[model samples]
Target: MAVHVAAIDFGTTYSGYAFSVSAPETDLKDVEILSNQIWNSGTAEVASLKTPTCLLLSKDRKISAFGYEAEEQYADIVLDGDTEDYYFFHRFKMNLHNNKNITMTMVLEDVRGQPLPAIDVFSLSIKALKDHLKSTVEIKNIKLDDRKTKWVLTVPAIWTDTAKQFMRKSAEKAGIPRDRLTIALEPESASIYCQTFPSAGCRDIVEIESRYMVVDLGGGTIDVTVHEKIPNGTLKEVTKASGMVVAGLRLMMHLSNFSFAYLADHF
Candidate 1:
């Protein structure tokens, strides 16, 4: 019997999940990415399979919303002059990448400087994605069963053991069964997805045993990994992953500021 597999990419900038009824490895083309994945469904300002990793919480520390819904609800909260009574966080995943010494007591501050436990924020984010994924899977007429469903959660290849463990714990907290979960390196996941579809751009490349690099430019951090194609068509990490914690969103902010300054100086 074919098994179902789901992957939750808790990305720094965007978070989303993809599920396939049949095993991804059994038939590469069996994977079907869900459409209209998140909030602001028709707005041209925001269109994508995933939403920003932003989240909104109640004063009592409960998750009020997430993604574009979170953004919109937080804006409403601010307009009502209740920003202080709620927590709104955006692109906070970079905190883990930026802090090499992340501790249980470490806290993350919201846009209004409201503080909450980092683990709480992460678990809330993961929970949001997990709940949404379950809803979508059910909509596909597939009964959401842990026994039939296996999950792969991706993480940066260069993350420390502590960070990796934290993510595993967060996923467990989100209600994913420990036996159904697998921690996959981000680069390896990307490579596997790419390999599923044979591309003309890669047809001319040297055959098997070729080593290639995977460079991921995410919203919160950049990661690069080197992998070698093995005899079994599987990829093996050949070199240590390299990257930094600088936010990809920062580049857009800097460019926007520079453009505004130049326009003001000229006109």
Candidate 2:
């Protein structure tokens, strides 16, 4: 029997998935790279990549939307409300860890002035991604029954144990099995891909006896790590790493506000 493995990069602003097929004679040479592209626009000049997150609502007071479409639709509706009973937001991953002044509201009400919990919002997003995986691939429906499909989910290294537990719970609420899920640090995963580059001639080798910092400036956070290279070419952690979630996109938003204010005065 062949095995299907799925890897999910569950990012803050964007998320993605890659799958592999296990078969006989499936060595590194036999592995095929799958194209992740989903949409194209413009005069055959613009191509948009797909991300595994969305906002959606069903007719029966349920939300629905996923991937790039969900993201675009969420933005469109948030800025220009045309749809009723559907409220969505992208880049919600950052808000998951934030506890200060964060508020979320749903359209449906049950006589109480309360909206859905944050975990519910996250579950809806996960469901959209799960639906996409089912529709895009040719896996047997029995696979769903067998519950053999496993997932590797990525998270920022700076996340606390509490945050990590919440993410696990959210995934469970989205129908992903607890035993099938494995969590990996985002920067560490990126480093794995980065380490392959020196062998590919993409970057020159740097030989240093002392420890060095690996600073990852991502869309939602800034991660810093200090690693020591051993004599056998293996990397070891010399000190504890740190990160700040209030970087990257937040900084850009601040700059944009300044630019808009200056432009308004000039115009």
Q: Which one is best on TM-score?
A: 1
lDDT, candidate 2, equals 0.59
Worst 10 residues of 2 by lDDT: 105-114
The reply for model 2, stretches above 4 Å from the true place, is: 24-35, 39-46, 52-54, 58-61, 71-83, 100-114, 139-146, 195-213, 228-235, 246-248, 251-267
Candidate 1 per-residue lDDT, tens place, 1-267, comes to 667778888887788888776643665555565543555633347677788788888899888998888877765665566666788777777677768898877898776566888888888898888788888778768777765678888988778888888888878877888899999988777787677665887642235798787898776667898778778877778888988766447676456435533433343
Instruction: Give candidate 1 misplaced runs (Cα > 4 Å).
Output: 23-25, 28-44, 204-206, 247-267
The TM-scores of all predictions, comma-separated, are: 0.85, 0.70
Against the reference, the lDDT scores of all candidates come to 0.75, 0.59
Give the worst 10-residue stretch by lDDT in candidate 1.
256-265
Per-residue alpha-carbon lDDT of model 2 for 1-267, expressed as tens digits? 666656666666566676656675576435543424364333334455556344555435376566666645544544453344464444567665554443333222211112456777776776666656655565433243226876666778887766677677778888888998877777666655554444554243234444556787767887888766567766677767698876668766456435533433343
- Each prediction's RMSD over C-alphas, in Å, is 5.3, 6.6
Best by lDDT: 1
